[model samples]
Target: MTPEDRFPGPELPDSGPRHQPDLDVLPYGSYYEPEPEPGFEPEAGYGYTTTSGYGGARFLEAHWPTASQQAHPGEPVHPQAPAAEDPPTIELGPPLDKFGKPIEELNFPYPQPEPGEAPGPLYVVGDVHGYLDELLAALHQQGLIDAEGHWAAGRSRVWFLGDFTDRGPDGIGVIDLVMQLAAEAAAAGGYCRALMGNHELLFLGAAKYGDEPVQSTAGTASFLAAWRLNGGQQQDLERLQTHHISWLSRLPALALEDGHLLLHSDTTAYLEYGESITEVNDAVHHLLTEEGADEWWDCFRRFTKRFAFRGDAGPQAVHELLGAYGGQRVVHGHSPIPYLTGSTHLDDGTPPHVPGPYIYADELAIAMDGGVTMEGRLLVARLPLN
Candidate 1:
């Protein structure tokens, strides 16, 4: 189907609001997506607030409790023991090159590509969120692509765990590189693929029907409001094209590789949609094709939920999710790792310095969102955890 057919504009009644209202109808200033659970304070060191006043500054603050604090707060909801003892993770070692002298950063120990080799290893990238330069640097550091932004890893597989757009500059540029690499990698015997991040859905909806009201449990809402609230960049929206929209609509919601279930969000809500991984992906993709606004909104809302595999009952949640979907562990990106590390940020308004992927929740789930937008590391780690 054509992109327009797949992403039809919102259906409007005869004499009501326009199906796609002009941007002039909305407020002028940059909008910030409100933090979930207003008035909810984070554990101790990692406190956050949405009402920070500065546009989108609230996103810089940390929220999720560290593994230690997981035992409290949500105890009633997550009553089970932690997933697995925190895996023996490699500490964020020193930086590969001197970016700064303040925080100690661990350079990903990317294996050098052997001469005339096929793909070297399986690696997963954390959220890109429109940081094209950082994403390029990270991939180069991992030796997945060469200096010219071409797929350099002949046989190594690299999977970006979603969130390719929004919040930063060049979201579309990031998607372009990924789409190019997917083709380049396959031609050379390797592969590159992406999951459908919530932002992708937001972009799709906003482009198709800006300001058109969609029914929600809370009331009538529009993708334009939700997108802006979530740090949508107008530049990204302006540069958005039909090809990008089509690419997004076709992205799978979940995948399983080498026993690791790669997903965009941490919630078990994927279960609500389908049983197996393929089934879940198909269900999500199918929902996006429908014309109803509420269905699409509900799909976006479900993918936006986080921390399902956290808290006291985190292990049980992981077990239940694995029981349904095939995977020894769940590797996701939506939730930033530093937020769960606890000792990340101080009260000085400094961004948390993440060294590597935060392996917590008894190691049953691996959080890859290094919080790049939050001034944390843009994580890229190999598979089959060492």
Candidate 2:
């Protein structure tokens, strides 16, 4: 009965193949609840952009066309009423986008979003794969927090776009309400900081009292068996072992603020590390503050890989992460615009029915993975929206 109520999306014109997939690996997810619930959408949210120059870095987002759907590109979503039986998946095998048809009817021109003095109820989240009541009903429908689980009460300024943990089921109560609303948005000045998800580098590369070690050039992959085959939820890994995976390994794949730029997993391997976007997010937070979580699990194994926006390398890998991270636009969360607009894939473990909330290339880039474990929908907003 769902698959976006049976395929209700259409708007092609971007197509694929600038591809870039290879931080190399193997991969794989589940759950709990504590409180918080409502729905989400007050202003706007999501991140990761770096294109412009080199005709958008020529092309490179490969890895067997990211498993399949033949590396999706526009033209073939004509379903509107006939493809609804499966909708709950966790294939984690063949689907990094190539499932196709939904470029958002091309019309690129972008560049007119620089008018901030800072009054935004700032929000940004993606990759809550555990769907804790759809991330508390999108943070109580963006009142930012109310209905229980305290915070600025509703001051809002949240940011998160990382794989808080595999699949879904309270990835530790969504990292305990984003570490208690980044300390109630810096005690109400307003702001939340989160970034570094490839399931937080596959839970610090399978910590069995680990000091570090989650190597991957792609072989024998073990972020604890790809975090228990993609839906890992052993009581949210013992409540993420009382925090301090070195403060989620000092997160920072990217972030700019106000002008927008943030990332979780949108690949292009941040252009092999640096060149701009503040030296590629300060050299990927300075090689995770100087390697050794198995040599930084191959840069969190290619920033938790994803289809460069599905086929013909989706708008030149979103213009090479928005021209090396400048961000007039680019808001990511690994690959979850229902796995980049194919609408639904993943076959047995289930989840992936989205045909709502999107902007894409002309908007410059904004996906915000809202497939919340499969019930779909766990997103928040707020940011330069008019």
- Cα RMSDs of all predictions? 16.3, 22.1
Candidate with maximal lDDT: 1
lDDT agreement with native, every candidate? 0.64, 0.52
Which sections of candidate 1 miss by over 4 Å? 1-43, 48-120
TM-score of 2: 0.29
lDDT of 1 by residue, 184-297 (tens): 665555567788877788888888879998876556778999788666789999887666666677788887766678888878888998888767877877788865777887
Q: Estimate each model's TM-score.
A: 0.71, 0.29
User: Which numbered prediction scores highest in TM-score against the true structure?
Assistant: 1
Superposition TM-score, candidate 1 onto the true structure: 0.71
CA-RMSD of model 2 = 22.1
Candidate 2 ranges with C-alpha deviation above 4 Å: 1-80, 91-137, 142-162, 165-171, 175-197, 204-206, 212-238, 241-264, 268-299, 304-358, 362-365, 369-378, 381-386
Give the CA lDDT, 0 to 100, for residue 261 in model 1: 81
